[model samples]
Target chain A: MATLIRYALLLATTAVLQRLLLDQIRIADVAADGFLVLSVATGVVAGSRRGAVVGFAAGLALDLMVLTPFGLGALSSLVAGAVAGSLERLIVHSARTLTLAVGFASAFVGVLFFVLVGSLLGGVGLVDGHLPVILLLVPATTAVLVLPVRRLIRWAEAPSRALSPALR
Target chain B: MILLLLTAVTLLTLSGRGFGPLDSVRSAVGSVLAPVGDAASWATRPFSNAWDSAFSHDDLVAANQRLQEENDRLQGQVTQSAIATEQLQELLALVSIPFVGDTPVAHTRVVAGTAGNFGDTVELDKGSDAGIEVGMPVITGRGLIGRVRLVSASRSTVELVTGGGFKVGFLVIGTSAVGVAQGDGDPSRLRGANIDIAQPVTEGQIVVTAGLRGSSFPPNIPIGSIASVRSDDAARQSTVDIDLYASTRDLTYADVVLWKAAN
Candidate 1:
């Protein structure tokens, strides 16, 4: 329950941040992919299933919150979450550097998926002549954000696990 | 993964097809989330404002340019006022005719902004309950913005003039030429069609609503100013490019004109 609430707050905060503030703050004329980073980070930490859940929720919020295609965000997020989770399954846990690597890679996968999917969805010029900048920003921004986001999700999930058997 | 992926694909298909049944769902979700979106904007207002102030040197410079224009206009207004007063005093010696009438109008605030880069609509705080119909024009002090595209009980959707499907009958101000201004799926660029080849159109010529009978918009609202004009000799018509005065990027409020087309 605590984890659910924490993730919910995180999703809402990220959506709100992206929409009202960050969308206006353009870097190289492209908005930073906030929800994608969060989804990828969550997937890496919580496993693929939980990560997909977060991605789906955030995607739905994104669709409803803004005027993009109704299902595009959800689709992109689902893939992101699943990819990160699959990566988690391959590596042994508990190495800080590995976590960061996973985070960066997850972010890259999520962003690349969104860009490709968005373009294919008939977004015509969805690349907007800024694909180079966007591609560079995606992994770069994701790298910058991965560790912090992973930490936040970890922080949120930690107490729940410790208190779980005790409280129930 | 498969199930979630399938579900997402189905939803995407339905959304892309614009299935009518799902409109209510979109509206419901939009209605539910509207408050949250507003709260987000409200919370970030101060920060965006401060950031724009502190770090936006280019914006500040552009703002100064606007201020300079406003100053010159205000100075012109002072001269016009003095001239108008003298004219009014002279007119007092003659008979006066006062004309007055009111057009139907319903003022509304913009509730939510464009959805994304591809967003072509804006959500309004007013809906059918306020007598906003699907075709009523939306306007601001500057000029025509768009028309009502969708309306629910407590909210409505406005199709900005920049939408791919949007078009308007436009008159080139100070010239006899008229043309159909249309959106090219690019918000910043509007294309004008059917401009008579013989009509000389220059850059920066203002355009306004034709207000033709049976049209959605009323007459004489400014649409945009001409940006470019090119003659297609084979077609015997000059293609004119227009730049709209209203941009959804910074819009926060609009008025829903209650006027309907006269059948």
Candidate 2:
């Protein structure tokens, strides 16, 4: 029960931060990938189930705020959470390098998937001129955000665990 | 089991058959989350405004004085021009083209934007109560911005030309070649496609909205100017790069055109 509440809080906080602070910061003309980073952190700390739940909730929240087709964010975040959770089993410690790598990789795949799906939906026009700029900014912004997000997840998760004796 | 549920929800949403359960869930969640989005946008407003004010202070002051003088001089000219234009429009109204009604402009406050992607859509403070509706064209003196896509009681979402889902039909200035101008998910860039290669389009040619059959937008709204043209020899199609005239980065208020086409 405590773990569930923790996951819920984490999801809510992630959504808030994504809209507030993280969304505002633009590095290399790209805002930091807050939800992606949060998903990876939750997936790694908790099991895949928790990761999936958090991702779904966060993605759904994002979709509601954004004007895109409703399910796009949920689908992408679900995949991202599952993949990150699976990778967490192989890694022992939450080193900065590992987090950075995960952040960069997930950010890349997430953005690419979004663009591909968006293009297929017949709303966006494709042009070669801005592709290079997008390519450079996506990963770099993700890489810079890993450590801060890792710390935030830990902080947010600690309170829920404290409230639940079972978690202790 | 979880994946199955997720897939089911996704499929339902993609089909667009109106998912009541999901929409309720979204609205519930949005209600909870809306404050956060509002706070985020609110926090940034001051800084963005301050930065813009700093950069444009001298020029803006100078322009304001010049504009005052120009307005005084152009008052008579405008009256005469309005009469002449109205007469011409009345004559042209005889043609079977859909008539665009007079539009009233409204100013709105920005609410939120997309966080992750290059596209920056804004939620406005006005909605259905203010006579704003979906498909209403948004513009500034410089050029076209985008259109209202979604609306709530007190809020509306504008999908700027930089957003993924924005498309407009435009005409090139020199040859009047008509093509489709669409958002590239980047504010600074636009793409004009399906222009005939031999249309005499050139670099720096201004592009204006070419109202489609039954389109909500009026004819000849400024869109952008052509930057480059790419022609494929065998495909018989060409693409033109356009620089959007609207500055999405600094936009705070916009004019929501409330014109409806008279049948």
Candidate 1 per-residue lDDT over residues B1-263, each given as its tens digit: 67778877888788778776566666666666567657766786798788878899798999999999998999989889879756755663363311111366778888666554444678888788899887888988677888886677778778788765678998897788988887765667788999899888999999988776666777667788999999999988998889888775668889888888888
Query: On residues B184-222, what C-alpha lDDT tens digit does candidate 2 reach at each position?
Result: 666687888988777778899999887867655777677
Residue B47's C-alpha lDDT in candidate 2? 92
Q: What global local distance difference test value does model 2 have?
A: 0.69
Q: Number of the top candidate by TM-score?
A: 2
| Model 2 spans > 4 angstroms off | A116-168, B1-38, B45-101, B171-177, B186-189, B195-206, B225-243, B260-263
| TM-score for each predicted model, relative to the true structure | 0.71, 0.76
lDDT by residue (tens digit), candidate 2, A1-168: 664665577667767777788777765566666676666666666645656666666666667666556666666666566666677667788677886676566656655665666556543443235655665676567557656666665665565535667656
- Candidate 1, DockQ score (0 to 1): 0.31
State the lDDT of candidate 1 residue by residue for A1-168, as single tens digits: 777778888887787677666665667556667787788887888889988878887777777655456678888877777778878789975676776676667766766676677667765344544556666766666667767888788976777766577657
| Segments in model 1 whose C-alpha atoms lie over 4 Å from true places | A1-13, A16-30, A47-50, A87-139, A155-168, B52-103, B109-130, B133-136, B147-159, B163-188, B193-204, B209-220, B232-238, B247-249, B259-263
